[model samples]
Target: MMKRLLLVAGAALMSGLVIAQEPVAPPQVDLEQQQALRDAVSGTSRGITNVMRDAYRNPERTLAFFGVTPQQTVIEIWPGGGWYTEILAPLLREDGKLIAAHFDPESEVAFFRRSRTEFEEKMAGAPDVYDKVELTTLNYDPQLPIAEPGSADRVLTFRNVHNWLSAGEDKAALVFEKFYAALKPGGMLGVVEHQARAGTSLEQMIDSGYVTQTKVRELAEAAGFQLVSVSPVNQNVQDSTDHPEGVWTLPPTLRLGDKDRARYLAIGESDRMTLLFVKPE
Candidate 1:
């Protein structure tokens, strides 16, 4: 039947007659990228516990919104537990670079020292997945560059803004400027943090870990970045942002212990705001 149709079309063409044809469908997705993300996120290398959190974290969508590609240099700030590291490591292992700016291993604080040590151990245990990750550290001194100035294609931080702001707004603003300095012109800065209601004071933000979008914008703008977009992929509307322990009272942290545990479990993760900013070219 195909041969017959071809012959008819040829004959029609020879006779100077036009033939009707079906329109080709345009591609709706980048199959290559989709498969890459799927393999990285769903791979057996990730911890089962981290995989279970996929429902709320939505790593795939969040990374996509940040315009992460396989070939760009990405710097992740404060990779405490290496949860995202599991996904990012394999994704960027083959072609791109994943620079983890983690806690200082020599910090006077015991938690920082222990966490960094454990993170190194985790990487050493899984060389096939994590060997290529270039490890670094982030600190309060904005002058201390995380990577070479204007070197990274993307700078990402998850649920870390409140910690920076805890010291004060100046510290947070300086850190934002550092993130800006580490990215190439027009490169992106992706942030995910617990969302606070508008009018929440800076003191409340420092205490609760929930920051207003307005405050985030102010910091980024101070750092010379323009807010390009915001995503709700990680948002939880059920959160009223007034828990006794703030965002920590939700699942994952559940800082309340067994008290009202069921209620916090039902609420799931805290309401989060995901923002993407671009350093101007």
Candidate 2:
């Protein structure tokens, strides 16, 4: 009887201690440091004001909407020129792992080569920040070898799927399947791409730099992922779906140069789809 009473008292004491523990804080990113990060990636030393205005405004919310925490084993696909890489690497530095994987440029289209040297240099410049980052190459073909199955916790791709569609093998879908196969059960795949209007065909997506949300959902569902959520945080409602040069004619790519600079600037970046999907257990 005495031993039973002692066990009950000990259990209550442990429960009280657990309840008394304070909740831990979310990761802290200082305003100044965030500004510095923007400046570092925006190709300008004085970029914080302009970069921060956009980054902190809408994009961060897109990331938050997807429930990206600092604890996942995240693989970011096609970290071209490391734009998002600059932000994500540091954010995941402390307790999380960030893997920056790019197309094997030796096998990719010619354009990726232009950024190859720059991407390597940018990441090399911050060895400490990327100490936990792993750089892997995606073969763009199904037969190519990659990590073991069920290895990652999340796979994220931003603004690059259209290029895969253009590659003609439906490498995009194959890659999506690979992502599904690479994650543990219940792992996530997060995507942000230029969004096309409903019913835009796949060929048109390759040509226009826009992909319909339906196409993406279909591909993911086919790969055994369950649609979790979609967010409009990155959506741009002003796009009229009638650009002469398509989505590339907008600010970041401005393919036409000075012809529609003012117009594209006013439109800002193209409307994007932010989608989240999870592998079922």
TM-score of each: 0.88, 0.79
Clashing pairs in 2: none
Q: Each model's number of backbone clashes?
A: 0, 0
TM-score for candidate 1, please give it.
0.88
Kindly report which residue pairs in candidate 1 clash with one another: none
lDDT of 2 by residue, 1-281 (tens): 99998898899898884343232222234565455334434434223544553632254665555555566677888887776776677667776778777768685467676676577877777687666777877767677534568888788888877877887636777888888987888778888989999988878898898989998888888888888778778888887655888888987778899996898888888888888888876
In angstroms, what RMSD does candidate 2 have relative to the true structure? 10.6
- Cα lDDT tens digits, model 1, 126-209, are 999999999988887756889999999999999999998997888898889889989998788999999999999999999999
- Candidate that scores best on lDDT: 1
Error of 2 at 250 (Å): 0.7
